[model samples]
Target: MAARVVSPTGRGFLLLDSHPAGCFRSVTDMVAQIPPKAGSQDRKVALVIGSSAGYGLAATLAGLVRHGIDGVGVAFERPPGRRTGTAGWYRTIATAAVAEEAGSDFTFLNADAFADTTKDEVLDLLEKRFGKLDLLVYSVAAPRRTDPRSGTTYQSVIKPLGAAHTTRTLEFDADGTPALRDVTATPAGEDEAADTVRVMGGEDWSRWVTALADRGLLREGFRTVALSYIGSSLTSAIYRDGTIGAAKVHLERTAEELDERLRPIGGRALTSVNGAAVTQASTAIPGIALYVSVLHAVLGDALQSPVEQSVQLWEQLTGAAPLDLDEQGRLRLDRWELDPAVQAAVAERWRAITPETIAEVADVAWFRAQFRGLYGFDVPGVDYSEPIDPDLDWPAPR
Candidate 1:
């Protein structure tokens, strides 16, 4: 389709252009005015991969709103469907609009992060446009990948550790009632785990940095970070201790390697161990909803939400004395993972609470509403009376 301007209903602008180059440039210009940090690097630029939604989008928004970063976001997903507001899309538009009103600079690149061509295109653009980037956030998560070298496609599957087991879980539609659901764990072979490593692991991260650095697209003393999670032991068998855990181990290792690679330029690769939040990716995992439900009940009592964790993450990246390790010298965020008090509390609650007691113990109602909100199912202020246009433009950029 020929490039045409579409005014977003609430805030930003959308170009209904099929050509990736023009679309990318337009979005980049829209958000390019964000101010740079004082007494630091001059002309700092950030590139956020997987910036369409989730943690990536959150980080991008925080960079602009909280840190005064002028940067570009590379997203892979389409804009929200009419009435179905994707939170990440909404946040992006809102952020861009605010940045524009404040005369900040920001940009958006919508493309597949896994494609080598996409990487090269981004690097070229960075070279031509920003010249160098001071920060890079790698947050792309894909279920499958086609190996460029071997031409082999690999798909990742989520399964519990050990044998098949049936667990009682809450069905949101069933009046918050407990129902027993049969769950099976697929035993992934070593090759399968290796393939998962090849796909979702850190190789792509290394490639992007190497390409950007070789092109002189990275500024000296720059920092690159990727977000990872290690949930509690109850779910570790399926996450950190399972097949996915294997992949994460490889990813952590890659971060160490990248750290060394970036050392010469004073660039550093950091891996942030983040707390759990609701996302399209997290919902499909086994037993996560229930755990999140319990967490909401316990944490919400203190008026804390998952967004608090996100804010903490942003502070760590941009703060004057950003969060460092605990007494043990490991990352405090990871220490937050292994905190004895937090672990004890969660484990005790997990054992004490059942599906029947879920509504009573945890804020099942709140969690359900939040889950629905993720998919634009149950937002409070949104008007459902009007017919939602699935293609409604996001109101963000001016």
Candidate 2:
């Protein structure tokens, strides 16, 4: 099949079409950056839910290339058909390719991870192929989920719990010029808050872990990490103190519960607060784009990319580096972004930010490029003028 050039198409932060070649290149670049294990012959088995893009994808790639871990990844992604596939679809294929190169047994399941059937399928696969799993990474970020038993659907909302939250946000025009505008996110209703908790909270993580343990698919030292975020005060109203924050609180609590339950088996469950990045999920949040831009401006070289954070996280998990946990017993990978000096600088910039001065106050260009790159656009070394074949197929799951 011949390849065709795919242009970027989207309104606001929601991208419409994704470039397959660019997605492949992006995953390849991430895989290349992970340093291999030094004379260590570790053969860990893992299952990473939502392991197609963002932090999930980075962690999957790091495990395969850095430690040669055999694993299975579950992600809900659209395959290439009438239009191009999702960026995550391409990234999954690219990750499987990396696994092949590293000689690790890896499987990618394209199915709804929130479903009971998917859980059963993954548990069966683990029992048959890779045996007991040493790690489970929960990084799902779907907008909605259907309760497998109750038959009720829950949709998540990004709104404050109390009164309305008005904040300065970043927006881009059609010509790619940046603008700072005030965005008011009204409070979520009681039903919306509960539904958001249902969809985004730790219930599913607990379910997965419980099912795996029941099926005897978890090893004695099994550890599960769920990705989470608690942003700076600038985004607290819409993020850390919002509907999503409520769900996160539930997730953290679930981790504690699971940690206690798994103690007899020498297992542990904990949440890892990851650094901010330009992901499809993050861009939709009210002030995340502006906050991330200012974060880049202030932290510069100190800022950890998703891949860097994943690499460090793996090191901590495998005992190569010291585990840094916050007082709440959650991994603190966002330490750099949450630094006192960095937050002070970000606060100053947030106060002085305006449409005219945003470019100078924040890394607007970098943010724009990062956003575009999420949909496989504006990627370095990609031949935009050349044609790309969007109809790509994922390798058969191992």
Candidate 3:
């Protein structure tokens, strides 16, 4: 395959390398530049669930850069190819190389995070190598999960809370023309809330922590984290108040429980509600592109990428910042995403957006660029049209 070029299709889908090597460059550059705090000693080891890309990957990099922590990362991804070799895969490959060159202990485990088999392997690896883990970051997001204990599979649904929701979804025409269409989400069925919770909620996280505890894998002063989101009113019905919202609520509660459980060990658990950003996970969610772009436009330099948030989250964990908790006892890292002034401006933009006037109202141009960056496109210093050995695969994990 001569460097098969891919672009976002009508429904925001694509299967092409947007400069795979550029993906490596961006993540590698970000991770390498992370500096340790003043007079702060580096930690020993870390673990990141869902670590292949996005927040997990950023957290993994941040852990290594800022705290000089070696890490074990867990994620499931398809292998490298014209079809399967993706940004996350390339990012992981880049990470392994950096770790190796730096003589740092980094292991990338390609496996299902929800499976007991994976947990067992991680336990064994931790005991053999690091002996214990100081940090555990869970950033897994999926449409489906199979229960490791009961062997039940659950598919998560995005829907409205009470009534059906009709919203404008931004998409491109079959001919690649940007357009807007109405996307209506029906109310959830009786089992959907529970099912979404089962698949996307904190059950897996709780299981991981508890399993680690049972195996004595959690070190003293251990820390663990999971990601969550609470968008503004525009996205509330389909997100913050819907099936996924129920799951997040449960996840927050699970954080409290984990905190209590880790108290004796002088460890802590936290659910960091992150800001909205262009990620594989968020892009797959319906009816949010316009908001994200507009948020970027209005927030400007205030918009923080996963790397920025990851560093901030790790800072508090390492006592680099005063811990700020909301009334619910949760970390509100989405402070900028939900800023009253920013929200007002975004709402104005949202009300003014249309197929014809979208370019004027929202920053789709910037959003599109960020979308390309997700797949390793829109990156400098790479030739996209260059061919490669089609049989190329990720570097072996050490």
Candidate 4:
């Protein structure tokens, strides 16, 4: 495999190494080695939407590596930069290459997931390529959309609530010391909230399932899962308790509708309340960086790396029985959010540590490194000194 570069019209270059095959083999071997839980189901084909980065990308790769799931990914964004490529792109290519090396199948579709046309295209491609899909993961998080039915264009914003709140955050350089920062609550108006719902919520999910089911493309006993988060009360006012929360509620409801529709096919729809991790999506929310940084410090050795979380999600999706559900019957991987003991500890720590005392309490070193790693900044093994191609083509693996 010669080195290649893929450059998208609006996006930057993505770098591909001469060893795509080798990268793929590494991923496949990793997955093949994960011990399956007792009575785990045999792995099958899977489809992952919003599979470019963050949790979605992790989940998809994990499915391949941990559960032996061979599948395709439909991503909205291409790799960043033509030569350098985003971390997600590297992961996707690596995943596909490894699956192929393992005598399995993989594909990467670059398109907007919200559009009906995109969904149809995916279905057609799946029908022609893999025939049926056993698991479908929805992990898209778009901020704006034009409602085709209503002809309304919706945009979302992140703002604080009520009076402006001055909060302390971790300075990237200083780590544990709380940097005094003021965050104004910019509540989204009714229209904005509705638009957020339109773009980020359940409506599109329901549509995708409906269309796929109607086409008879889903396998029997299949599972469809979406990711959701309900953070702590500290940040819930901006996340689960605010405009985004409203959208998530709508998403949950959409899950219910999806469950009913999939019933006849012996399929199910579920939403997982995932544990919080550092991702581009999480960073934009007010106060999350501090909370995550703090949590990372506490978890220190105990925390599941993004790779570990991906493994957990794969187990849930491909495990023998259904995933462990919360009181609401939704899948719960709230490692940080649901642990009462941990939450109490973190809240207490948050209150006690201020700008003046942060350095003494938190692990600034770990937090900054992790933050940089989120954007492919500080990966340990990648060769940053080498010249990278700015043009790479990453079409689905044929």
Please write out the lDDT profile of model 1 over residues 1-398, one tens digit for every residue: 22233222221111221222222232343234333444543334788888755667666655665566676777665664332334455445555665565455666656677778788878877777678888888887778877665777878766544554344344554343444344656666677777777877888888888888788887878888877778777777677876677777777888889888888888778776767666667766777777777666666654333334545565665545566743422234445445687667766777777646666766667766656554444455444444333443554322
Model 3, residue 124: distance off in Å is 0.4
**Regions more than 4 Å wrong, model 1:** 1-43, 79-91, 161-168, 174-182, 301-307, 326-330, 334-338, 393-398
Looking at model 2, report the run of 10 residues with the lowest lDDT sum: 1-10
Please provide, for model 2 over 295-385, each residue's C-alpha lDDT reduced to its tens digit, 9 standing for 90 to 100: 9998886888898999988888877788899999999999888889889999998888888899999999999999999988899999888
lDDT of each: 0.62, 0.91, 0.80, 0.68
Candidate 3 C-alpha lDDT tens digits along 287-396: 88778877887888788878888888888877779677889888878898888998999999899888889877777778876777777766666666665433346666
Please provide TM-scores, in order, for all candidate models, with all chains considered together: 0.81, 0.98, 0.93, 0.85
Ranking by lDDT: 2, 3, 4, 1
Worst 10 residues of 4 by lDDT: 6-15
**CA-RMSD of model 2:** 1.1
RMSD in order of candidates: 7.3, 1.1, 2.2, 4.9
* Model 4 lDDT tens row, 129-211: 77788998899877787766677778876654343444555554322233535466766677777777888898887887778
- Name the regions of candidate 2 deviating beyond 4 angstroms: none
